[model samples]
Target: MGLRKKVIWITGASSGIGEALAYEFNKKGAHLILSARRTGELERVKENCSNHEESVKILPLDLAEADQMEAKAVEALAMYGHVDMLINNGGVSQRSYAVDTEMSTVRKVMEVNFFGTVGLTKALLPEMIKQKSGHIVVISSVMGKFGTKFRSTYAASKHALHGYFDSLRQELYEHNVNVSLVCPGYVKTDVTINALTGSGEKFNKMGKGQKNAMPPEEFAKKLIPKLAAGKDEIYLGGAELMGVYLKRFVPGLFSKLLKRVRVT
Candidate 1:
């Protein structure tokens, strides 16, 4: 169960939860492959790691580019010959109301959040199955569990991930390739500021709730232990996590609460 010397590839690793997880995993002696669209930022994260020279490698990638995933996966596996884990953490966020959002924006979000993640997973899956060991972890949002205002397509994309990954997990059970979904509530990150608006422009403003959400480092600290324990589904955040349960058990009440809660 220990991650020591394990080859772990993490996407969206330039900042936020991905970066934090990179540092934590590096601390645990894991060989890290840090990936993101920005090679410079990935280098920055690498330099900040405990043993960057020997333990960390940077791979630049854009999750929205589905066609490139297969090659990327091949390159990732080449980093340390075989990967023990792949964390599907790269994605974009939406801040537009459903009525005002453009179709292109919806497609863009889905490309990065849903199809892109799925493509990469499929590309690497056969290798994992052949190795008879691997972990696929996704950083899905709490939105995957329920819906609210201003996140129609974002919620839809995450919901789709749940359905697809759930089915994939069942199929991979016999193959011994573990699939886990990490549902995170609001966390202190640039997700909101970088969120696409109705016109497909960046929101560029920090959200009220996001400003006070759990720190990425703290979230990573709590998540790594659960992952090491081989948990299938892990939820991390503050009180916002309650919304998931509330939506599941008391649909009527959760619907009412959503009307009043400040999501953005």
Candidate 2:
């Protein structure tokens, strides 16, 4: 569908893929609701948009606070009277082994990555169904398709999104609502630097894969058309995307390869 004048609400708009998407969508003449925990960073992103004064609205949100999602959804619907699309892009990453990770840390990751996303979607779903039109886009990861070292909870959270949204897609299909699950391989973003450790502290270091991953802007540029095409499942990245296939068709070989790959 054409994006001109479409009201798109995107979480995690302060940085990374979400930020790039805001700018790209703005370029397509789409109205934007930018959200994240950092109000200042949200404002920075808004100001950087093409028509920030008229087309962009800042809505500071913290996904970890899932309880507030309904209220936030009401506030968002009030902004444009209706939302054409909701991008579930706000999430935290884990950089800890499952055995080393504390239960609290696991809960924190699951809360932010899975529960929070689902809560927000559930809040807005009624409105979309009422309108009989909407697009739900999720920015999942390659880890969603397969597990690796140091990302047990992170991978689980992503896997949960696939299950939840895949089912949601079937239910929403007859209602004219579209659901897109976007599985991104490594992208050059601060996700790694801000990833949670076993103790819940920030990883604070960019991994080799992350440093050399696709640029967020480039990734966004390639993603917009696929989104417009209403693709049910979208995958973007480098060779890492191949793992999704390997795990699907040749689990034995994929499992052997996983042991040797440096996942961080």
Candidate 3:
């Protein structure tokens, strides 16, 4: 996973962490296939990159639409021959009261964040197995380790990612396919503002935790090497990495701490 000439495909590359990652990885000399719904923004990102402009390829599509991912992946493979790593970062977050949240909103978040990720992973896995080398990096959240108030669906989706990818790592070990789960806590991104509300509308703002979040570039700089080192799962956040170990070693106390936490 130490890039070099690795053919890496990153979904959700339009902005935020993904955009910063694209530039950083491009500088590292990885051939990139960038994916998102916004072709214009992809072009803009490509324009903004300081080097390796030709290394970036754009594949625009909605992650929620699982039907299209397999085909699009084929198109990517046709262009790049093979993908050494697939960073499944395309997802949405839902932050709303569980009781008041519409079923549609919950399902939409799962469809994009969990199930669609599954679809793309499954699609690319065969080739990975055949090549006997590939890495699947999932952009999960700190909520994956510990759930919180008003973010039920998003937490569940991220948690589901951990369940699936961790299992995949164990199952695919002999085949040389590695799985890395990235849990970022309150990264400075538009994620909170675009998070879905209970009524299936935009949340239209940021939470207090988000206001003091880590910069995406700094987060990526800290994270990429761990991934390159083949860490199976890693967490990123200012004060939130404590939650991951706390939940594992002291569940009851972690629960009590979470109860008093003012995440919003």
Tell me the tens digit of each residue's lDDT in model 1 across 104-154.
999999999999999999999999999999999999999999988999999
lDDT of 2 by residue, 55-99 (tens): 999999889999999999999999999999999999999998889
- All models: lDDT? 0.93, 0.95, 0.88
Point out the worst 10-residue segment of candidate 2 by lDDT.
255-264
TM-scores for every candidate against the unseen true structure: 0.98, 0.99, 0.96
Task: Looking at model 3, report the run of 10 residues with the lowest lDDT sum.
Answer: 46-55
The candidate that wins on TM-score is: 2
Q: How does model 2 score by TM-score?
A: 0.99
> Whole-model lDDT, candidate 3?
0.88
Comparing 1 with 3 on lDDT, the higher-scoring candidate is 1
If both were scored by lDDT, which would come out higher, candidate 1 or candidate 2? 2
RMSD of each candidate?
0.9, 0.7, 1.3
Residue lDDT tens for model 3, 38-147: 99999888777655456878889798999887898899898779999999988888878899999999999999999899999998999999999999999998889888
- Cα-based lDDT at residue 8, candidate 3: 85
Off by over 4 Å in 1: none
Residue pairs of candidate 1 with colliding backbone atoms: none
Runs of candidate 2 exceeding 4 Å displacement = none
